[model samples]
Structure formats: C-alpha cells, structure tokens
Target: MNVTVKYFASLREKLNLSEEQLTLPQGVNQGDQLKAFLCLRGPQWQKVFQETGPLQIAINQERASWQDIFSDNDEIALFPPVTGG
Candidate 1:
C-alpha cells in the first residue's frame, strides 16, 4: 500500500526530505512497526528515529499513537515535541 509521510524540523534534515510517498509491505501496518522498518534503512534513519528524539505522529491529521493502524494513502506526519513560546 502507498502512504504519504511528512517530516518536520530536524526529522526533515535527517531523512533529507520534507515528505515522501512510501510503498509498504503488508505487515507494516502500525506506526511503530513503520518506524522500525524505516530504521532498518541505515544509521541515519535508525539514529534519527529509533534511539533519540521523541517523534510525534499524526494519522490523517489526528494524533496517533505507535499502535495506530495505517491504511492506504494515509497521511502520516512526524514532528518532534513542540515548545511553548
């Protein structure tokens, strides 16, 4: 299935893209699972998303937890915690 991923702030620099269209395998349905899969890409992905920096996810503009299920064409946005002004 195809999904749209959006990255913000440091995450965009880490992956080197603001957004991307991903074609995922069947078992890659959950947000956490998807993160794990991305980490498998290499050091950049692993370090940027795996060990450090808490990344927030929004599924179709709604806040989503790691266990949230993703569907085809879903828009997933990733951003770090926001700070108050």
Candidate 2:
C-alpha cells in the first residue's frame, strides 16, 4: 500500500523534509515497522528515529499505535513529543 508520511516540529527541520508519498515495502505493515524502514534510508533517519522519544503517530488524522495496521492512501503524521518550559 501507499501512504503519505508527514513530519512535524523538530522532526521536519531535522529530516529536511516536510512530507512525502511512500510505497510501503513488503513485510512493513505496521507503524513500528514503517519507522524501521524509514530509518534504513540513511544515517540521518537512523539518528532521528534513535534519539527521538516516543513519537505521536496519527493515521488518517486519528491517533494511532505502533501496532496499528495501515491501508492504502493513509495519511500518517509523525509528531515529536510535546515539550514545555
């Protein structure tokens, strides 16, 4: 399936990408696995995924869990943990 992946806050700045259309690879059918697949893109992605705390994931605008299965044309938003002073 294909999906739109969006990065927000520091993640967008750090990754140098706001969003992109992704065609999910075989065996990558869940939120967690998708993250792993993205991290495989390069060292920067690896760093982001490794250093960031628990991210807030939204599938099709609704909050989603790591195990949540994705479908075609899903809009996936990844947000960094909210922080405050």
Candidate 3:
C-alpha cells in the first residue's frame, strides 16, 4: 500500500525532508512497524527515530498510536512533542 509520511519541527530538519510517499512492504501496517522500517534505512534515521524521545503521530490528521493500522493513501505525520513556555 502507498502512504504519505510527513515530518515536522526538529524531525524535518533531522531528516532533511518535509514529506515523502512510501510504498509499504507487506506486513508493515502499523505506526510502530513503519518506524522500525524507516530506522533500517541507516544510522541517521535510527538516531532520529529510535534514539529520540517520544514522538507524536497522527494518522489522516487524527492522533494515532503505535498500534494504529494504516491504509492506502493515508497520511502519517510525525513530530516532536510540543512544548510551550
């Protein structure tokens, strides 16, 4: 299935990308599974996705959890935790 992945805030800078379309492999249907797939890209990705603290995820603009499943054409947004003074 095809999904659109978005990066925001520091994650955008770290990944050097704002968004991209992904063709997910079979059995990779959940948020956590997607993360694991990206981390396999290399150390840079692993650092931002694996070593970093909790990230916020949204599926189709609604808040989503690691267990959330994905569907074709879904939009997944990943961002760092928000903080306010």
Question: Best candidate per TM-score, number?
Answer: 3
Alpha-carbon runs more than 4 Å astray in model 1: none
Q: How would you encode candidate 2's per-residue C-alpha lDDT over 1-85 as one tens digit per residue?
A: 8899999998898888999999987888788999999988999899998787789888999988989998989999999877799
Worst 10 residues of 1 by lDDT: 44-53
Query: Candidate 1 residues 1-85, lDDT tens each?
Result: 8999999888897678999999998899888888888888888788888654788889999998989998999999988887899
User: Higher TM-score: candidate 2 or 3?
Assistant: 3
Q: Provide the lowest-lDDT 10-residue window in model 2.
A: 49-58
Q: Where does candidate 3 have its weakest 10-residue lDDT segment?
A: 47-56
Query: Considering only N, C-alpha and C atoms within 3 Å, which residue pairs clash in candidate 2?
Result: none
Full-model lDDT for every candidate: 0.88, 0.90, 0.92
lDDT order of candidates, best first? 3, 2, 1
Per-candidate TM vs. native?
Answer: 0.91, 0.91, 0.94
Report per-prediction Cα RMSD to one decimal.
1.3, 1.5, 1.0
Clashes of each: 0, 0, 0
Greater lDDT among 2 and 3 belongs to 3
What is residue 35's positional error in candidate 3, in angstroms? Answer: 0.3
